[model samples]
Target chain A: MSEHQYPASLTHGLSREEILNRLHNRLDEPRYEHCLRVEATAIELAKRFDQDVDRAGLAGLLHDYGKEIPVETYKRVIIEDGFDPDLLQYGRGVWHGVVGVHFIQTEVGITDKQVLTAIARHTTGDPEMTKLDEIIFVGDFIEPARSLPVEAKARKAAETNLEEASRIELENTLTYLIDARKLVFPKTLLTYNAFLTKE
Target chain B: MSEHQYPASLTHGLSREEILNRLHNRLDEPRYEHCLRVEATAIELAKRFDQDVDRAGLAGLLHDYGKEIPVETYKRVIIEDGFDPDLLQYGRGVWHGVVGVHFIQTEVGITDKQVLTAIARHTTGDPEMTKLDEIIFVGDFIEPARSLPVEAKARKAAETNLEEASRIELENTLTYLIDARKLVFPKTLLTYNAFLTKE
Candidate 1:
């Protein structure tokens, strides 16, 4: 798809350029750009945290792979894959990250369990998260294009402390959901409590 | 306890006077006073919503019956009674309502299912709550002695709409929990989402 060739280091089964091409076809311009920023952000975090930068970048780039998939498709995947039936009540805002992992593994040819887990948890974090998961989660929140004041604070925290950045981002998200009277996915609260109680 | 005799209509298996004596023996002065205020508040809300005032009064008065029990006792009950083991992680703040129903049934001698269910859900509300559950939950938040500005607002809302009041109280509780960096019981979020999406 893209004329560009990606380095082999960043390739997870499929070449990075091939992944970008699929993303371009699937995502609108803005969402595609967001994935790029998240990839860059996650790469920086991975470097700082001593994780595999290539894996982080790959995971971040394809994190929202299923973001633009049709709702009907996601519903069918949820049932067929034996995903939680309760997920049907939520729309793309939640499904894009959770059920999206299916598309990432099968369509994009990324077989790394860690990468898929990070993407699956990007929208609603898990009670126990790996370092890659934290990087992607915070990277998505504090991407350069994000201008929220809370995002700015989280970005500052991400510079030195990934866990603190995650905490701020998670708390801000919960606050926004509660204030707006939006339906909160249960796992988000579980993630919040687990992180806090662990400290 | 005192030289006070409670009305016969408000008795649920146990006489009101006997219940008061047990409460006085178990709870400290402040908690005992809170229970009385909650009872009055629940009664007022019941009258406004045309629910049974006696049931509301009884449920409210005994809602916090386990609040004063030792943490060890609550832990034992959580295990022996087959309560969710995850509940062990939370303190009296959550246990006093959910696991307290057992104590309400056995020790307090209250057998009304509606009354027990209301008390059971007073701390972390259920996804599908009865009118009595809303009454006790809101009563605990908007009781006359509660002076927090949010509580006052919830009290005002309770005067006309129980659902709105419960929403306000739940949101306020969530906000407080997030701000305080406290561990949240997952059911609280479930209750909140269930209420909002139902409307």
Candidate 2:
């Protein structure tokens, strides 16, 4: 409770490719490439933040690891596997994220808490954004390949101050999700909220 | 994904006492008691479904294990734990159910995927529930302690037809969450939505 208390998946030091190989074809070719792009973006942010590039890259690379399952299977797996299916029903598809973290650690045998924590949190980026977690999150949405108008500013911030860049990217992400009437993953808002307070 | 993968923390298999002990120290004393009561409720539901009461009981007892964290910590852990905060902001406090599964397996080391899944989905029972998952979910909400006008009927359904009873319970629970201005966890609604399609 004092620090980030996590198990193997959250902390193991798996490289991006190692994590991708561990994905074991869960993702199709396109999604895998997207993850690879996200990992690259995350690495850029990591350099800016002076964070662990490997951890950030891995987190970005594996953010959607559980997403390969059809939405229906998500619920089925949660029920059959004995997880809460409600997570699958809602916004930003967190059940996969939650389940992905577990799968990576237990099934894949990666035990680096930092890497897992980054993956666990990249979607909603927590209040206390560890350098790596923030990088992976912002990098996910604003990587060079992304075509968002906000990316330019986000890119600029990443080159200067990472926390500020993450804050901007997260707020923008929340705005997009909210405007879309999408289920705003609370952590995204929480990340935004936390950023607001910090700023 | 094919056979339902769970982590070693989840598959380790814990005794009821160990489960309670973990909950007792981490959660409010009353909530701990609620867990025990849910176990009994789950046992009765197991009877209705002709499922394994012991596994149902264990799942019921630990459904809200993550609820033990103080609100601040719960907020932080779940968000930092990687759940999209957008999901949380929808006013669904029920996330602990999903988050609980992750915690039990990763941190607590109870690895039975089914057990963790059952606990995760208990708040918003899934549609394709395992015989065991359904039993435990029904038990958690309608346990002898819950006080609702339809509680008696729900209990009887556990005796007569579990699937039917679950359909009713899920309906009422979703309505209650909606009425209370709470965000419905998608998985719960998916379960409810899926059941709505069936007989």
Best by TM-score: 1
DockQ of each: 0.88, 0.02
What interface RMSD, in Å and to 1 decimal, does model 1 have?
0.5
DockQ winner among the candidates? 1
- Regions more than 4 Å wrong, model 1: A1-14, A79-81, B1-14, B79-82
**After superposition on all CA atoms, what RMSD does each candidate show versus the true structure?**
3.2, 17.3
Candidate 1 lDDT tens digits, B83-102? 88999889999988888888
Model 2, C-alpha of A44: deviation from truth (Å): 55
lDDT (0 to 1) per candidate: 0.86, 0.66
Give the per-residue Cα lDDT of candidate 2 at A162.
Answer: 75
Docking class of 2: incorrect
For B66-174, candidate 2 gives per-residue lDDT tens digits of 7755566556766787876755553325667766677777666777777777777776677677777777767765777777877777877767777767777876765
TM-score quality measure for candidate 1? 0.89
